[model samples]
Target: MNSVQEGRVALVTGAGSGIGAAVARKLAAQGAQVVRADITATDGGVVVDVADPRQVDELVAGLGRLDVVVHAAGVDDPRAKQRIADALEAGRPPEVTASLDAEAWRRVMSVNLDGTFHVLRAAVRAMVPRRAGTIVVVGSSSAFDAPAGYPHYAASKAGVHALAQAVAKEVIPFGVRINVVAPGPTDTGMAARTPAVLRQAFAGLPYATPEQIADVAVFLAGEESANVAGAVVLANGGRFTV
Candidate 1:
């Protein structure tokens, strides 16, 4: 019997590592033709920085038949993340909002928020005409429960949730479904570098693996989630009941 994704064409950004890589591999294993994209050429993936709208548009436009699109490319400046982590560990508050580093904030917004918009816009344009497609955005649990030290990351994800919701409505009538999978901290390279003290904060809390999150994303992208649309599925390891 043919699998649900057999012969389907899918695009996954940030396919170089972590959740994005996992999503790409799962889709391929399920028999989908997965196009891997990332800011770097890791794994010989297409090199396109989501932060650039032109690159995102071109990448989507070039995909002849896009049955599914998972926008998973995202970043957090490790230096800034660690600096705030360190301050919080020492019982000192990180800089106030007014004094937050402007560049760092802009960098996160550009890639997380603006980049999401660019990818969604381009994907919708391609999917609407065909009147059949699904989109799964990798979001952050921080958007629901604010983070202690990373306002930029939290804010960007919150914006992503809203954007996906708004756009989902507009596209559902055209047979395209858009949803978000917001996961808590997973065992990714980005999380591995987090300060020990910070990791300790969630020591006993539920932590997830990249594959686990990928399972959720793939589920939402396929027929199983056909009735699901414009929803944010939180895979945050029992952190919050909501």
Candidate 2:
């Protein structure tokens, strides 16, 4: 709602929909020259996958002056999701090690962990030279709680949290800050795709709207959170305290 980001340049991954789209919109509305990058074309965003290093480089190069980076592109392991539903319906935690297929695990890790690294690496290259920028990575409550079966997703996000902390430490001397925002079960299409029972279980806990998470992200990207670095802000409304 404020114009703190006026003249800033922000690049948001997965901006085609859900929380990414919300963050992109929030940054733009706050007067940042938002480059809404994603894999799919949405109403007000550009299309680019953070997983591709070349694409990430191109996107940053096009920005001319990259000020902020919000890495939000990620995926859940499909096999784990299915197994979790079956296990929950049977009243037990799914045997992820036995049930999850390799492909599913690889897919989730590639998009969530590797993709995050790609985006952050590109952002760093673009920002370090100018010695000014911020990076807000989108982690998840699951990274802390790590629900029963989604090991791949949890592991990837955990890596994200760690990476953010490391980045913050390594880049502070360059006048760059890196942080993470872990949102709870938000009302989004991604949440809708979760099994109904799983959704209900998460719903029973505190949940925030996409806008709320966006607010936290924007704060991390702005000078308002200047003292905040190597920190992970849990936006999960008390669901998971990490």
Using lDDT as the measure, which candidate wins?
1
Evaluate all candidate structures by whole-model CA lDDT and list the values in order: 0.91, 0.84
lDDT of 1 by residue, 1-242 (tens): 98789999999998999999999999999999999999989775799989899998888888888999999999876766677787886789876465568898999999999999999999999999999999999999989888766788899999999999999999999999999999998999889888877788788886699999999999999999999999999998888856
Q: TM-score for model 1?
A: 0.96
TM-scores vs. true structure, each candidate = 0.96, 0.95
TM-score of 2: 0.95
Candidate 2: tens digits of C-alpha lDDT, residues 23-97: 998888889888888788866677777777888888788888999898888876555677788888998867877
lDDT for 1 (candidate 2): 50
Clashes per model (N, Cα, C within 3 A): 0, 1
- Residue 146 displacement (Å), model 1: 1.1
Off by over 4 Å in 1: 96-98
